[model samples]
Target: MAGRWVKPEVFPLFAAVGAVVGLCSMQLVRNICTNPEVRVTKENRSAGVLQNFEEGEKYAQHGLRKYVRGRRPEVMPNLNKFFSDPK
Candidate 1:
């Protein structure tokens, strides 16, 4: 059946590497999309926090688009106040 475990000894090392490469490409797509900054090498996008829902969503959409377009994210995170993070 599908996904049956195959004995490692049955395949050459290169075969294992090829299979890994195929699987890794899918992971790469996810990793590329998840970053607020769509930039693959830089942190250009960031999730923004705002006091109001309208403003917060506005920036979130901006950030999301930046990555989707392969551009840098301009989202500005909340900088107006600070709170002790939950322990």
Candidate 2:
């Protein structure tokens, strides 16, 4: 019988590593594309130094961060509210 080159037991390990690497790469790309500090357009690239510092500061917070900033912190908000109700 011909011997198999790769054992099947290691497939899950390979998949997990690949998933981590893919997620990291995608996050890096997303940051590069959306970050105000890292301008990518031609107009933005040619702007005078310090010209938009104030504007940049306005959008400095990441989208997710801005959304979460106004939210109340809770491990499980729905569950906590349910148990804490006076009914």
Candidate 3:
């Protein structure tokens, strides 16, 4: 009979670690492809340091930050609003 190379108990831990690594790698690839600051075009290469710094600052606002900019500061917005409402 063939011997078991890996124990069954450690499978879930391996899966979780793989998932985290995959997510991070995908995010990095997405940023590399979409983020202008990371790309060096002919115009960008010729620009001065101050211009590059300003451009970096302009693109530094990530998608998540833009999404949350208008959101209320609450852990559970709907639940909190429901309970806090005066009847």
- lDDT of every model, 2 decimals: 0.56, 0.78, 0.75
- C-alpha RMSD by candidate, in order: 17.1, 5.1, 4.7
Among these predicted structures, which one has the highest lDDT? 2
Candidate 2 residue-wise lDDT, 1-87, digit = tens: 334535788679879999999999988897687656676888987874655666576657667789899899987999999999989
Clashing pairs in 3: none
TM-score of model 3 (CA atoms): 0.48
Residues 18-55 of candidate 3 have per-residue lDDT tens digits of 99999999989967876655655777556644445554
Model 3 / residue 31 / CA error / Å: 4.8
Off by over 4 Å in 2: 1-5, 49-87
Query: TM-score for each prediction?
Result: 0.28, 0.48, 0.48
Report the poorest 10 consecutive residues by lDDT, candidate 2: 1-10
How well does candidate 1 match the true structure in TM-score terms? Answer: 0.28
